[model samples]
Target: FHAIMNLFLLPLWFLSGAMFPISGAAPVLQALVWVNPVSYAVSGLRHGLHGFAETPAVLAGPAVCLVVTGGFALLTLAVAVWQVRRPFFQT
Candidate 1:
């Protein structure tokens, strides 16, 4: 689980534009960033802290981030419950 989380989070950090602006990334990478939910959260943080000198077209604003965050939370909760209820090994 730790290894899987590391594998997932490493790309998430990079592709979410935490290390650099998404605009400066390669076209393929930019496409990936747009699809990543973390990118919207980063955009919201940047906007709240620095203001959007040039907002990315993909980000609708903080409201979108809130909605996405809530959705992810609910999804995670549901998955956790499902996992807990399921048998570790089927007969």
Candidate 2:
């Protein structure tokens, strides 16, 4: 079910306006496009193509992305290490 849901999501995302612009649609319907997770891909594509990009928390560029991603990875690693050592402390 997980894999099936993932597969369906990819195409559904495409139809939800991630593939192209959907102008003249009703306001409510357009709102759906904006809310769709896949719509982010479209926003990114549009921004990249137009040479005007705005990623979330934009004041931070590649450096920030790198730092954030690395920080999260390190946090995960630390948690994993603690879990591994937890049995030793149970006594």
Candidate 2 lDDT over 1-91, as tens digits, reads 7997689577657656645555655777677765554454445445455554554322224444345446655876998898788877555
Q: After superposition, how far is residue 36 of candidate 1 from its true place, in Å?
A: 0.3
What is each predicted model's overall lDDT from 0 to 1?
A: 0.78, 0.56
Per-model TM against the reference = 0.79, 0.40
lDDT of 1 by residue, 20-86 (tens): 8777889999899887877777777777876657755435577887787678668879998999999
lDDT computed for candidate 1: 0.78
lDDT over C-alpha atoms for residue 58 of model 2: 23
Indicate the TM-score of model 2. Answer: 0.40
